[model samples]
Target: MALGVVGASVCLLVFLAILSLDIMGFLSWKNQFPVDGKTVLLTGGSQGMGRGLGKLLAQKGANVIIVARDVKKLQAAVEYISAAAKSQTQRFHYIAADVTSEAENIRLLEEATTWNNGQTPEIVWANAGAAKPGLFLETPLETMRRQMDINYWAAVYLAHTTLKNWLYPSDASAHSTTIQAPRHFIITSSSVAWCNIAGYGTYGPAKAALRSISDSLRSELNLYNGARRSTATTTKPAPYDVKIHAVYPGSILSPGLELENQSKHPVTHELEASDPHQTEDEVAAAAIKGLERGDYMIATNWLGQLMRVSGMQGSPRDSLLWDTVGQCITSIAWLFIGPDMEGKVWNWGKKNGMPAAPKS
Candidate 1:
């Protein structure tokens, strides 16, 4: 009984210390970026998470530009967002363009800037993505390529185009005079990017690529902003405050999710059954909340949070103490839970007979 009391006291002391550190860290972090009156450009806004985010941003008084391939759906989404607008000045627009095409993404940005009175978007959401779930051998090469193009390359193109257009200009004179606002670029990855399951071979890798790119951009932007601020000649405007956020969302109930579920392996479903499945609105709310808090890494669910801490690779830390605790938990899970899960997956695959790889 005395030992138990000592252990409990130690645990309470540790918890209090962590809580104090988190509070101090939160206070010292960058100020929250406001969404009100900002122009936000969102891709894949025709439905699901994109549409939900659009509505929420609109309600927050942001001028929202939604881009997607489906004209009908885009139009509907715009109308819905317009109805949700909190202010008369909060305009909602739609662009019908394929984000998978670099040229089309350029065109989409051109139109968005033109509509926003030649100003670039203050917040950019690279939310367009697709998944083709199957065993590595069964899925077609073209299908995997398409997923990469849509999920990875499209985001790259948009981020590149946005940064080039907003940060750099053809004329050096104009670049010096540009008054920049705080900018945020958000990329949507999946929880499976870090926690690779058997059925998500293509999708997992693509999202993982996105997370890597986001991390790289975050580092580069930090350096760029620091250098520009340090070398200011009193002529150029202060360096742009650009932030990159990577989101790892678990199961969401949306049209895209439903389609993914239809083709997903039974084992994949069984393994993920315990994780909470959020609605589109729930995901959007969580994502926006994370953004408001200036979190470098956003996880929409507990499972995503676990995967994030477990597989974290040099990303910005939100809370050192909590993150360390999560990492410890992840290590234990890897030693026990991971192996058991892998064994189950192997057994299931062997019993069910996975499809053979396509011929080269």
Candidate 2:
């Protein structure tokens, strides 16, 4: 009798383990993706994270559009993506316009609408902006204004333009031979949005503003009713609102990190390491994965859900401590257990004249 009881107990334990594993697998799969042919446009697509995303989406059968002020560099990027995606039909486009201008933003969207091979682009990633890492008093006022122009103003202007032009509802027939489509707008944010760092007098504020705007837009769009025929001029979404996702990440290793180190405020923010600088290709892969899964918050190098849980708690100091420690252990675990592909915040130790974050 005792042996039979022990056998039953063992069977119950095994069943519970399998159930738990299945649940966890579903949660993880919630953010993984199947390939999507949806069109995507990336601003600041000349290099770094933008270029990375442009290539990944193109490779995934997406019609990718890249826009920046550098024409020669843009052509080079097109060739690079063409090689990466290996698809002759993977259309690559570029429009040279400074995003800060409202007229320029509108013109870019108009161009995007026309370039879609008679279809509308359904995804847009606004990754253009300036980040001057310096103390508030040390950085020039003009630099701060420029950050706001590119970061906050340009993003919303593009979001509004994309909606009004490409995603807007029209009188087309429901029976028409058109594919059912949903649009999405993704904005790049930072951890600085939640906690302002010591040297982000300029960079932090602009990201915070972007965070606020993205939240408000998401809330309003979610409340919209599509059946209503009323014309709302506000930045509201249609009944089936386009998904707006905010990607909050820490330091990214880009060539711009080299320039940031060279600026007059040399020892400003942290820079990436030479060995483990997370390539732009990796960042782009993670982003496309997150977008296809419709994740609202994608922390590319997420250590664990602990950071998000900590962010939900009150007390600024406590939040910072939780985030810093969790991120460290999480990153360390990646090195030891998983692939080092998860994002890591590293220090350059003044070799490039960039200020290193005080040792965690």
lDDT of each: 0.84, 0.66
Would you list the clashing residue pairs of candidate 2?
226-239
In terms of lDDT, model 2 sits at: 0.66
Instruction: Give the per-residue lDDT of model 2 (tens digit) for 151-212.
Output: 78889888888766544544243224444454678898765675554467788788877777
Give a tens-digit lDDT track for model 1, residues 1-360: 999999999999999987886664464555466788989999999888988899888888899999999889998999998899998978888999989899998999889987987767778999999777876877788899999999999999999998876556443533654655678899998888888888899789999999999989988887666656765544443346677898888888889988988778788887776889988899999998888777888999888898889988687787676788999989888899788888888888789895555677
**Could you tell me the lDDT of residue 103 within candidate 2?**
94
Top candidate by TM-score: 1
Q: Say which candidate scores most in lDDT.
A: 1
